[model samples]
Target chain A: MTNRTDFPPPNANQQAFPPPAAGNQVNAQNIQDALEKAVAPKVINTSNNKNDGLNKCPRCGSTEISTQPGTGMLVCHHCRYVFEVAVAVFKDPKELIGEAIGTGAGDITIDETQVTIKCQGCGAEVVVNIEGSMTSRCHWCRQVLSLENQMPNGAVPDVLLPFLLSRETAKQHIEAFAKKRTFYANSHFKREFTTENIIGVYLPYMVVDANVHCDIRGKAGDVVRKYTVGSGDNKKTYYDIDLYDIGRDFDLAIDNLTVEASTDKLNVNNKMNTNNIINSILPFDLENAVHYNGNYLKGFNSERRDTNINDLRGLVDAQVRDVARFKANSTATKYDGGIKWESQDMDTKGSQWLSAYLPVWLYSYMQVKGNGQKLLHYIAVNARTGETMGSVPVSIGRLLFVSSLIEVGLLFLVIIFFLFLVF
Target chain B: MEALFAQLLDSVDLTQVLAVFASSDEDGVGAVLLLLLGGPAFFMFTYMRYRNTDKRHRHEIETPAEMNNLQQYNNFIKHLTRQSSSTITGANDNVVSGSLLSNGGASKSFKAINDITKNFK
Candidate 1:
């Protein structure tokens, strides 16, 4: 079996990932030079396959490099040196935004689920399965193989947020959350709740940075006078509010606004799984995000982005408008009474889109209804920050019984008040 | 749509609705007060009841075999504020200058969000 090359053949029209520069200056041609610089000029892994691993230690030329768990750093066992992965950056952020908005999600149509790659280490023909795993091991040389370049099915992301929190830390957070939520949670859930069930996963997300122009027109209320009229049954409070037409215009630079890039986790209708709870744990530190490396995904489970940028355009637009409205409201907080925003328009000046894999620790429990309908309740903790949120399945009978008693007590108090007045 | 409108029109009974509210000790006023103040509390309780009833028979459960779950979302507003403050301060003027159409930066692109010139006396 012949060995595969390290990177895919460079596409003429595709954008390039800008390499780290001396002055941080970037242009389209510089980006191409950086891309070439990041991949080539040395040990060609003799493999012509696209899915072969590129984990060779650049220092000692040894293939014993592996990613250190909890930290995304690739450590070489042979040379005892750390290798830095190259992050892809564009020359102009504006061009990135234009491409994202102009091109729909169907940019690449990859029909094949697998790629044939011959291992450079042992000349063994290793079949890289894109459907499930990103990497494989050569049966002959026992060297780890990886998918080195961007795949057509969008398996490899532009960047990734590595897991910073250790397995022990994630376990502690999960255990604490389960213990705190055990009171109202289903009995079965409590019985099944164990720290052993918590697992680390890299979920797909789209990181968006934008320069937005927003215009908002609305009516705001300025309070003039307040007075109390009448008493007892005829008691009334009146306010004279002066209304004025208000408008605001501003340019906003938004960064690291993330959206779910996969459809399975984005599904809101799934009663069995609290998928929204998983979404609530976003806002990963995109600045700390590193260049995509297959070695970093060695031990963890990762989901590739199945959904496209076009599918989430409407959602991102709504979020942008929401942020714009919020910013406008900040300026008008002096109108404490309230402002009713009637019309809002947000125009995209420029934007950037990059796909990433964010880390998460998750534990879920399933509760079935009497009618055999199953619902999955999820408790998720941000693997990095240890912040926790979950949907706990609770007993309706107990809650209803308690609430009804309270309602009855309130009715009794009302009846007593009426009797006292009559007397 | 026609059927829905017809059904809604047929369901309206002003006198019957008034009588039900009037049955309360303080007449319709007490019912109105209850609706205005206690509606949310009652609705929350009803929602809990429904959720509780629905989850009584859940069966197969699946979760991760190892502890890898949730991460805290950073404050995005803080990031936005920092970036805009930099623009105002011209901190990244070089980068901004390189990107803008005429090297004028964000100033040329600014437009009033709510233009209220015509309505003023």
Candidate 2:
């Protein structure tokens, strides 16, 4: 392999391209040959055609396929045969080279909402709205038909993490959270809060694995002498610090860094909505994500991936830089005073992108203030890890009144002590 | 017994104690001001606690297990001396702190990783 630094610089007087020779003057044949030599971007094909059109039980061949509660497996209603989608295998982060993207992570060039599938049971055609739902039941034969293939509109993803936490368990988690904050909660929110409104949802996320090389240069200081001078109000402390130049270079392999793909959920405006509450429950168990199967989404609602890989390049770059900075801290432990990073550079040697749906149980409430200003609050539970977090509207007036009372009580005690001292 | 208790109480001069508190000194005024500000402080504390419940788990980036091809360089540059009222105890003091000169928009917690590094160093 040739190192990039070993290459010689181009001469200033040299023509970028030699004047076209007699037969090579920009012709269609030359252009065609150049185009043929160009290499297309690498793609990791994750498409499975066996379960493409109509999904049926391998045993009894029933179309009634649904996920079993508390278990990450699909079950047929009639035959009761339990199975799961094939697990997706990806290359190790260190082995990743160049830019490889999963087929499902491709750009959404088409705005498609409706897809018609020919029912295998009664030979009837059914239209499944990809926007609203991916699975539909045929009216003529009553056989369930699902859209299993990856669509260009980003409705379907490469992998799906089935819900492991049941609705009942999620409700209990939300209830316990709300119970703790009931006292400071707004009056209207308290009155309307209910765990029954919680619904299981599959949120869109873009999972990335990258091979990165980082270099950081900074200045660090070490205290050589420390002493105190003067006394009373004039007391002062002084330090003689020795500064040093520090530099670190390392290679880091980052794995399974997930980012929200939907535009609505990515907008985490604290004032307008509690969307960040959803983002707080990160780091789902993406390693267990199965191959794309519509049966996993039978009873749950899902949000589609609106943003493509290009749209998320900025976010991925920033996050990768953060990870690099964090990795360099381990080797920089000798810098006692602290390191102020003057320059940080991270080069992405290779990266792979894949789209997936992660499960979450969400409960929301609208708190309307006396002035008619409203704020939406959310309580989200990670269906995989059961990690819960939420925002509750606070009753500012009530809280202030109680705090005032506490202050008055302290003042009364002070006055009583003074009186005792005087008498 | 009751008479003895009364005599013991009268032995101490309560007027002197009262005069000490009523002198209107800096310490006395400062104590009163701090007490008066307690209510507002409590209000703000409780408000932030209930409002930002989602920020409890601040660690969004997972720390990697290992780093490869590690290379380190450190060269002594010069010495700096400064005088101030603030006490400097150890290397972790405010005088010798680190920050990101570039990419200022990075999370404040990422900068805090420097503080964590100080523990091991």
Report lDDT (Cα) of residue B103, candidate 2. Answer: 21
Give the CAPRI rating of model 1. incorrect
lDDT by residue for model 2 (A1-423), tens: 111122121237643223333542557774454344322447777768644457888899888999898997899999899998777889888765567788888999888889988888888888888776789999998889998778788988888799999999999999998898888778888888888878888999998888776767767776777786676555556777777766666667788888788888766555556676787788787779888888888988888899988667665665666667756655656555666677776766567889999999999888776657677888999999999988888887798789899889778877886798799
lDDT of candidate 1 over A136-193, digit per residue (tens): 8888888878886665576777777677787888887767766664544556666776
In angstroms, the error of model 2 at B17 is: 34
**What is the per-residue lDDT of model 1 for residues B8-121, given as tens digits with 9 covering 90 to 100?**
323443334444454433434557446433433552444333222112100001100111111111111111111211112211111211110112101111012112111100
Give me candidate 1's interface root-mean-square deviation. Answer: 21.0
* Candidate 1 residue-wise lDDT at A386: 67
Q: Which pairs of residues clash in candidate 2, taking residues 3 or more apart in a chain or in different chains?
A: none
Taking the candidates one at a time, how many backbone clashes does each contain? 35, 0
TM-score of predicted structure 2: 0.78
